[model samples]
Target: MSQSSQFKAMEDYFQSLLNEGAPEPSRAEPAPQVPVPAVVAKPTLEKPRQAELEQLLAKVPVTKPTVAAPVQAAKPAVPRTPAAPPPVVWQNIQTEREFQALFFSVAGITFGVPLTELGGIHQLGKLNTLFGKPAWFAGVMTQREQQLNVVDTGRWIMPEQDATPDYQYLIMLGDSAWGLACHELMGTEWLSRDQIKWRDKAGKRPWLAGMVKDKMCALLHVRELLTLLKQGVNIDGV
Candidate 1:
């Protein structure tokens, strides 16, 4: 039998045994029982009047002090890129004549610097960071007893990403302490004037000279770049 069935049978046997052994009532009648006493009700309290309540309230302070909410600071204004591509400023850069240019990469983007505008190159050294400076600044590195201000190239060129790319070498701008941090040196190559898409008028990027046709890289206008860098502006002029 199942456990439940066995339990039911045991229960039935016990009930039968209890019924057989149960006591019987006597035929003679017993004395009558006394009646229960009545219970007393509690007295109800009267509610206070409006005037009495007002008087009680007046005893307490009239006003409770409140705390003011904290205010958030407004962010600084940022410069915007043009909706349309800007015209180039270097009109004579792209011709049949060839000029040697140094090619390099930062993050993933490539940029070419003209040999005539090239200053010097240095492997990354110990950088001394400062306080209360712009985000595009990559600290300063001293090489050969000369201090060079390093630019976080990726952040300066593409601020939206706000990237910190691994820098291997510093490409110094002509005769300036300002150097751009880059990952790789793609070496120098002679490029004809027609090999680059020169900008006739500087648009949003005042630093860009032209787009190298073969490498699909940016060509830097060193003179304009130095001016922008001296003013502490990024490629977007901010």
Candidate 2:
């Protein structure tokens, strides 16, 4: 069939249906919209209440930053002063019977004589000149009811001192009448035998036995002096 014809038929068919009073097609109803539940927002906190809460929180005590105290170094202890040293004590010891000696000077030369060798020490009381004697002999002095023949020790050692005759002491020679005129009598002193320098042989003067280093004096040998006296070297200037 031709397209115009087919359209005419359909139009006639619809017209017939209208004439026949055909029921109109029912339209489907749209489904009812579901009601959405509204979201209820919580109320915002008030500014004043927030401020009060902040003030209460501020009132609470907070721990402050603690700074450790500086450590102090201990001071050094002061050292005590040492005590003074003990005083020195000198000891005098001797094994043998020999002991201290006495010293005197003549012509500025010191001479030491053993204390055991001395008979006595006397004062130069009224020195009476004896004739027919050498210039070395000073004079005579009476001591202890005995005549002591005093020799000028200074002049004997040094002939230059003969004119002045400066005699002060009469040192007796071992219970003999012979005595030495000394200007001074020095005190006694303890000396060890090792301190003296011994002589091997007799020198020009037998009386000088050794040298005493302690007092820088010549040590007199009493034995040699007695031997020389026995030889009558200076007896009456013979």
Q: Considering every candidate listed, which one attains the maximal lDDT?
A: 1
Kindly list the per-residue Cα lDDT of model 2 for residues 74-121, writing each as its tens digit. 999999999999964322222244468888866566788878778788
Question: Which candidate achieves the best TM-score against the true structure?
Answer: 1
Tell me the RMSD of model 1 versus the true structure. Answer: 26.0
What is candidate 2's TM-score against the reference?
A: 0.54
Candidate 2: where are CA atoms >4 Å away? 1-98, 229-238
Q: Residue 220 in candidate 1 has what lDDT? A: 89
Model 1 clash number: 7
The TM-score measured for candidate 1 stands at: 0.59
lDDT of candidate 1 over 1-238, digit per residue (tens):
9999999999999988888956766778887988888787876545667678778888998687888889879899798976887755343333337889999998878899998888999999888998876788889898988989999888988777775857899999988899999999999999888888888786777678889988999898888888887887877787
